[model samples]
Target: MPATVFSCRWFALCALLLLGGCQPDQPAPPLDQQLYIWQRQWRPAHEQALSASRADFSTLRVLALQAQPKAGWSRARVDLAQLKADGRPVIAVIRLDGQLPALDLDRARAQISQLLADWRAGGVMPTGVEIDHDSGSARLSGYTDFLIKLRGLLPPSLKLSITALPAWLDSPQLPALLQAVDSSVLQVHAVSNPRLGLFNPGQPRDWAERWGRVSDKAFYLALPAYGIAVLPDDGGAPVVESEVALNRGGERRELLADPQQLATLARQLRAKPPAHLAGLIWFRLPLPGDRRAWSLSTLSAVARGEALASQWQVQLSARDGLYDIRLDNLGNLDRPLPARVELNAEQCDGVDGLSGYTLRQTPKQLIFTRQSSARIAAGGQRALGWARCTRIDQGAWNVYP
Candidate 1:
């Protein structure tokens, strides 16, 4: 054999080895997704929201009933006709007030039974029943007993599930509680102090690891795709204002989950999924006119581990000295409306803005300002204002972050 031929073969082998080592990592497997339609009453918009989100979520968890401190009990007027029409696997969520003094097993059982009857009569049979009681750690033993009794009355074909809290991990009875149900949904959203905001990005990963070790059965994680408005503290518990109206006398601070951060977390969970971790469940599906929830495009992207972002652009149209200025979001995420928008115009007869914006005009400029933060939906545009001028150059505009 020639020395040159031997050297060439050796180099080729080395190149092949290098290529193998440099191959891209395997893509993470897709995770199953579910959504919680938590509105108390089913309106026209709920049907629209559900119809549009058919591709993103497989199962629907509807708010069926809720028990409050003094409100006795109120049932969710869920749209049965629509649910029957959609014909998707549904889970009815029954909420028990976390602050209740004791677990009234009899009352809760009655409520569950009646709810099942009502739903069945409407031709909307639920695949499972989930008790969303945020009971305390000390009450875990009692809660377990209640669940066992509740499970006894449920149909054999239907599954029993529970909405579990991270704090339950410290309780020794958590295993027993898990045993009473087929599967559990670990709610990692809005469990911490309201003053600390709704969710802590780093904390959920640690909690998930610990929960995975303790639970033997299949479980899913409940994540936040919505925001909460925290009313000013009045020396008592913070008021959480969701879709409900709160007439409390104080200012409200809006806190929302970051879509990009959540998207990254989803990717991490998929890349190295926890043991027995079934999938992800997004809390409270967003509707068409929902102000606190993320847009469907953004939520779907996060669920699929896609990059989250919104592209903001200034749209200016002029016809015979009448110019219409607007802000449009071209990307797939909702964008916070600009605090201030400034445009340099050569000459302006008059200028103004709309939707909580005031016009600030200078000799050669036009400005629109708003006091509170708002958002522009993906593929949606908002009218910033219009100007009657010779030329309102589209290129001479600045939008402040």
Candidate 2:
């Protein structure tokens, strides 16, 4: 062969080796420096959570008067009224510390009637009423009787809601007790303190499933805002803290609402949606003066809604413009808002000839629309979808598509 042609062939061979095709496409550049925005920032990861509510009032049942001292009933009533005035439907639980003044059934009837009348006249009839009797009282008979009579006396318009003993799910009397009320609530506190009945061991999901079997109607799962300290089994009363305390393991531990656990509940509900999964209720309203209060608020937000936006991914061929995304359902339960979708280049290599891209749903199969542009690069992933959903606690529309 001629020297000139041979030299040309050798040069072309060298060019092919220099390109990554010689080395198995260079393993797609080893995915150098990737970014991830988890489902927390995305939409519809969990449906059971309530939506982010701008208005303070939410439709889910709320338990009020839990944090007030026993002596503060009258004051607590007024405070609770204010919450009602704010348009939030509340569950007014009169805390019964096992003290009844001389079996005044007649006076009690009058008081109950007048209270209901006044609340109704003010257009603030509670969603329901409850008695917090967790003291393992043998006097439950009297309390139960009072509620039975009260339910009979009150008009059917008002709902009767109650919290049961930790053992109530298995209590033989629970069926009769449930018969008197519109709905029942099971408080799921970690029994670090066995003093307050057997800490219903097992997961909230399991408890919810079991509770579903006990009641044919909707019910609420009660989650405490604090953690309880289990004392030595000398029959000492257990201590409950709203904040994290140091464990004997010397670990800085706090018992607050765990979002991941909440998410797990959400996932379970999504997977199996209990027949009796009425809703979730957080114990003690307005949050006590503790840092866990923030956790409560965050959990409330998660219950309501959450949204996520992916980092601006680059598609060299993507055109620079707004891309319309048609999601399968538009996430009606999420309540997302209108937002800007901008075009951004790869922070590292702006010269990759505009790699291919698209604007699609998170779970691609859930999308209902196609890309507005032929090739969507940076602008596609930034496109926004509006999603709306009803929150379990706060019945407000949560937007997060």
Candidate 3:
């Protein structure tokens, strides 16, 4: 070979090697879809929920039990019998209260051992056990110690994981904590105050990237798929209400995680998935009647990366000299309630909008203006208002012009 040609081929090989080294060692593969069934108690709705969601969600991370501060352990009402029948693997999770000042290690292990034995007797073997503790950054050392000890009881066949918080990224011990578990779930949501909102589109990607750089273990992002209502307590701090209800009477503020924003984030993650990133696990599965959560149709659409859209339809019913107004969502995506609705009416003695809408009476028409950003779920209907009118065509209403 000629000396110049040999030199050129050597330089070309070096350039190719350097370029390959600069990029990710491997291309980001398709993300696996999973869900966190965080409901403290199981209900009949779960049967249908599991069946409907089984097609999209490949695995479930269930809240098997909780370790409360003074309340000790509150075992979840999850039907173990149905887990195997559902035909998806499950990861049993034990949530320890972040408020708890101390870790009761022995009791937790005893409870877990019994829980596992019970599950086995019930003919269900979970894929792994995940520890979900919202410990502060300062406690990462102690938390890692606990996880290391907990690792002993888990068999080699089962993989151990933890529900990690974004705040832990600042802790140096985070790597050790990751080493103690087979994997971790990075939760990107925090409903601190309604004013701040449930999710910020840009921040979670930052967390995923930071975590990927810090840990070698495989991890998944826990995204929000639900909303919460907040009310002020006697103190100034906000009290968040999720699946459970509060008995106190006070004005409430609601914060919802936008479906569109979540869908956009999902696509972005798929485009450039973080290192060791396995998939996404949506927080708390949604039931058909879950007023605070997105509908299954919306979730499925978001999971599959279908286009986000919604079509509103005005449904009017008249009987007994009264007309009722309802809006139906014809599209698969959940949509923000229309801000304005106008309908021509011949004789509307009185009209009023319901819930998030307010009625405005014009000389010849009735108008409804939305008061909030509440969204109507896909394939669902909401009664906007009613009017006692002499005559109005059912198809005369216009949602927005």
TM-scores for every predicted model: 0.91, 0.50, 0.86
Give me candidate 2's TM-score against the actual structure.
Answer: 0.50
Give a tens-digit lDDT track for model 1, residues 1-401: 99999999999999999999999978655678999989887888877888878888999999999999889888999989998888879999999989878878788888888998999999999999999999989889999999998899788899999999999989999989999999999999999989899988897778888888887898889999989999987788888998776888777899998887788788889888787788899987888778898998888878867776677788988888888888898878888888888888877878888877888888888988986688887788888888898777778888887
Candidates in order have lDDT scores of 0.87, 0.44, 0.87
Q: How accurate is candidate 1 locally (lDDT)?
A: 0.87
Clashes of 3: 0
- Candidate 2 displacement at residue 202 in angstroms: 3.4
> Which candidate order results from sorting by TM-score in descending order?
1, 3, 2
Assess candidate 1 and give its TM-score to the true structure. 0.91
Q: Per-residue lDDT for 375 in model 1?
A: 84
Per-residue lDDT for 311-382 in model 2, tens only? 322122222322222211121121112222222212221111111223222321212232232211111232
- Clash pairs of candidate 3? none
lDDT over C-alpha atoms for residue 367 of model 3: 88
Per-residue alpha-carbon lDDT of candidate 3 for residues 175-211, written as tens digits (9 for 90 to 100) = 8899999999999988244558778888999999999
Tell me how far candidate 3 lies from the true structure as C-alpha RMSD in angstroms.
Answer: 3.7
* The candidate that achieves the highest TM-score relative to the unseen native structure: 1
